[model samples]
Target: MDAAFAEYLDEFTRRDWETLDPDAVADPVRVAVVGLGWFAREWALPGIARSAYTEATVVTDVDAGAVEAVAAERDLTGVTPEELRSGAAADEYDAVYVATPNATHLEYVEAAAAQGKAVLCEKPLEVTPERARELVAACHDAGVPLMVGYRMQTDPAVRRLRDLLDAGVAGDVIHVHATMSQTMLGELGSDTDQWRLDPELSGGCAVMDLGVYPLNTTRFALREDPVRVSGRTRSEHEAFADVDEHASFRLEFPGDVDAFCTVSQNAQHASRLEVTGTDARLILDPAFYEREDRGFAVVRDGTRVDVDFEQVHQIEEEFAYFGHQLLAGEPFHADGEHALTDMRALDGVYESAETGRPVELGD
Candidate 1:
């Protein structure tokens, strides 16, 4: 970590917000939503509407019609993009969720921090490590929380996996293999020029979009940074010339554990992670950071222990947790610094792929 970021983390860790009483607080945590896109309309707004600790006070987007429609649908007052851009609406909210395209995260995050509002930004926090660090610094200097949308942190299955690993049940994790792919053709049909297809906006291709999940999952599971990464890419469509349609990478983490990840925008379906350890192997099906039925099978010497659940809604749980933290003035768990660490790992992978050589992460 950079010196400034390290200092910020130290300061954050030293503060305690759990002791604060939510009921004693005079006002609810006012929140504003930026970018009324698909994810915002479909997932984020519903989650926020259902959260009790925070109120959706305003919604903003470049398209007035879209913003107005979403605001009316969710029964929220609308804030125009002009108002947000000119800082007129900054003080109206205690926090802002930037659900814009990947490329716009930094600008919105910085703007929110400048306005003294905490921020929750969509994934791939920023396109580059420097940008991510700058956002982290801005939030730190403002003394406001900046959270990334890594919803897996709150998933029940993930929580269980973390507990099992920490308890030494998965004993000395040796290797991890994960794959995530989706049929993007229908989604991207004719709209090949969509922001997600644009390298400048999406950061990379399938790797940055879908691959970040497994990358983050592996990192979280091991609770360690990868030391090195090697990757290769393949493309089936011309629209993906600047991006990748499919890619696979190998990551070497500390303690000699290896992680193999594959992500694609052109595949038929998805596959989850399989973690191998000295004592057992854990298979997690229907992975990715959503609330879905996930099957966990523990195999020891060819004997299997199956674990299953009715699938928990991760977005709801994630927003609920964030609401509680916000209500209590608690620091964000998936804070900007943590997001920066994940972005650094992403940078290494991209660099490795471009240079055709394993990239080493610097401490």
Candidate 2:
């Protein structure tokens, strides 16, 4: 734990920890959301508003006018990135929520960490592994908490499956398959310069954007990193004229388990996860983006297991967990190292795809 936050705990006794007012800790972590993009406005902001451990303290972006507009609507003070860079603005929050473009995420993370605030960065930490390593190092040097926003890990079904794996309910995992696809080609359009379409800026579209869900889920299920990866890419639509519209990859984990992932920007709405072990298998439908809103079934042995999870908003659940782990002074699950590990495997996926060969991974 950082000395800064540790001091706060010194004020509380063990009894205080147990009897402390829940409302006192509710929205205890003041968060500065660094972007006003779609995800930020629609998902992250609302989640913070409803969180028991976090509150939206500030909103920032390079475009002052747009930020000001959002500030007016959300009753938040909008600050510009340039203002933060020039030190015109003081750090006013406990942590940062980075929902900016992939290219700009590291800068905001570093800026927030400069003031010793924790950070929750959106998924696919960087366009490349090198930048991800740098971000991880920055958080380490600052001694601030760093969590990657792999919200799938917050889902009840996903967590239950992870538990089952730990309990050996699925016996020994033998094979896994994950698929995440949406008709995003139309949403992203065919613009060659769109941030999502530009490999240099947003990284590869389907693989880097949507592929991380399956890849990370596989690792979470196994609780181990892939020793090797084999990948291949195909472009079947003009919508992805400049980038690969589809990518398929494989991860070789220990115990001779193989994980196959298929990703696409042109496919229909398809999000499913399956894991086969020696004794049984677990299946998750609409896996990547599932909340209890429309019930996500956890099927095993040809029957629906009656697992119950509180139906809180997905983002709220994630932020609540982040806040809990931070205040408890513990290492988090989706830490920088976790994201960096995913980046390494993802980088290997691309390399293998390009060379049409399997890329061996290293610890």
Candidate 3:
């Protein structure tokens, strides 16, 4: 390996190195990465590659050129998604990592379950609630572990925020306000992965991609699902004619806990999540993915307490958590059900946005 790549790999795995022990991780699931996209290569796989408890044995991607390049770099063979599911290569790995775009999640998930292979799929689980629930249920019936990759939920800073809430430092989660925005697609639909501009491929714009952080993290922090949701989706720029370029929504929890979020495809970069309670309020600055540093602050009547956690490698935390569940022989945190909950809430958000009315939710 080149020295630069070697250094990068070391840095990637060093932070979360001791998170999992190979010996303690029973049956130690090996991974077959089904997509070699940006997240799969730079963010997800590097951790899997360096993890002691898990190994990536094979990979598959629709982009043949990308897959071939990755295969050569990693010295691993690439297979077709079909081959990964049930062809000659079916039994080669213990789990599958589904990192394809939003729309294609269900297909890979179902295929993985058909072979009784455990899966760790990326966020939005599936673009639609029905498919999300079906995939989760299928994995359940097939007796396979299904985990959705919500990296921010595993963040140390985010975890500390949760701890504070759990400890009642925040009294009760009376309200939460979060906003995530970036201008990655400056030219709008003209950017790479232009497919994302297609509502069919992206599900919805900012809400499906960026808003989901606040949407899911609220549930993670409060440990409660919203009882109702209302939102507005808009295509601010002509460039995003087909898909929403920006979205803002509000979620109402059972206790009247009010959570509001703003996500956009074209905006000055900002990522923040703050939760308010009777006694105090907690804040997470730069709270989502790809942030260089995520910091937390808590404020009481007249006092402010701040915590700056060392950046934890969320991918390692995710893999370690999954491995721990495998060793313990049980479904645990961030399981399929967890993803389903977020999907249900998101479903309502979309409905409310489309109907210009509040959509109620249950369970």
Candidate 4:
């Protein structure tokens, strides 16, 4: 190989290398999906099908009709949430995936923990930090492994970015700017009665649902937590009256690393995360949504080096990672305690938004 070309290939090894294995495992972990929402039915189910380490063997939902339809179509066992809690199908699966609304996580997790089954709950663990603590404690007490679905941690590009930052490829990080937004009503087919529009179910709105992506991703990449936060929110739509439609917040991490983030449930679709370092800039365009194409690059010294890796379904990677950990008896990176920190940060943001002042989160 040419020396220059060999060095270029080495750059890719340093910047973007495949980290996930997609080959089928000898014994896959059986999962019972607890919710049949669009994301569960669409992305998550398909992702599970593609994963080598996991398989969906059972399903349940509050809506009997939806559950029946999905179970029949996929040839999966359909059970009531009550039956699951009662341990009727306890032997059929090794893990329970809780994808229900934000506030309803505790009951499902408690049920699964009682059955001595592992759990994979979607983020932000629960609507509030208090409930999140309870959920974490439940799994801890049961002596079962608990993983929160922060799928960004499993993305190949994101994993590579974290490695580069750790290697000082971007030098010391100074600041970060991120934004994520989309038209919520249209995405739900304009259903005014959706849970996301409800304050109690969705946990105060756009920031909880959308902004947490950037916030959590930042924490994962930097391996640091924010120590202070300032926030503001507004809602003009009738459907969003009880929740926020738009939100913007500034977070200050230790070492003077600051982040500015904006999110909206009623705006043009956009997502981006830019990290400014002393010697270079790293950008992940179309960062949050798993459905969008991702672009990552580092810019320095009047030159740009784009990192490329095979893009797999990020949710699929998430499931695969969880299953592999359970099968190998390894600990998870996105455990319950890791998610609780984000929940605390989110609670602080809401408080800051309401009080028109900065909120301090002890380091």
Query: Which candidate number would show the highest lDDT if scored against the true structure?
Result: 4
For residue 267, give model 2's deviation from the true position in Å. 0.8
lDDT by residue for model 3 over 1-363, one digit each (tens)? 235322322332232324345666545667888888677888777877655567777889988888788878888778877676664577678888888888888888888888888889888888888888888888999988888887776666676677668767778667899998888576333455565777888787778888789988888888888889999989867767887788999999878889989998888988899998988888888678553577777788877766534576667767766655665566657888888878888888888989999998887
TM-score of every candidate relative to the true structure: 0.89, 0.88, 0.89, 0.94
Model 3, runs deviating above 4 Å: 1-27, 186-193
For candidate 4, write residues 1-363 as lDDT tens digits: 235322433543221322435464677899999999999998899888888889999999999999899999999999999998998988999999999999999999999999999999999889999999999999999999999999888887777677768877679999999999999888757888888888788787899999889999999989999999999999998888999999999999999999999999999999899999997788889788988878888788878877675667888888888888888788898999899889888888999999999999863
Clashes of each: 0, 1, 0, 0
Those runs of model 1 whose alpha carbons end farther than 4 Å from true positions after fitting are: 1-28, 187-190, 289-291
Between candidates 1 and 4, the one scoring higher on lDDT is 4
**After superposition, candidate 4 runs with Cα above 4 Å error:** 1-24
Residue 286, model 4: lDDT of: 76
In order, the Cα lDDT scores of the candidates are: 0.77, 0.77, 0.78, 0.88
Worst 10 residues of 2 by lDDT: 11-20
Better of 3 and 4 by lDDT: 4
Each prediction's RMSD over C-alphas, in Å, is 7.2, 7.5, 6.9, 2.8
The numbered model that scores best in TM-score is 4
Clashing pairs in 1: none
Instruction: Give per-residue lDDT, candidate 1, residue 49.
Output: 63
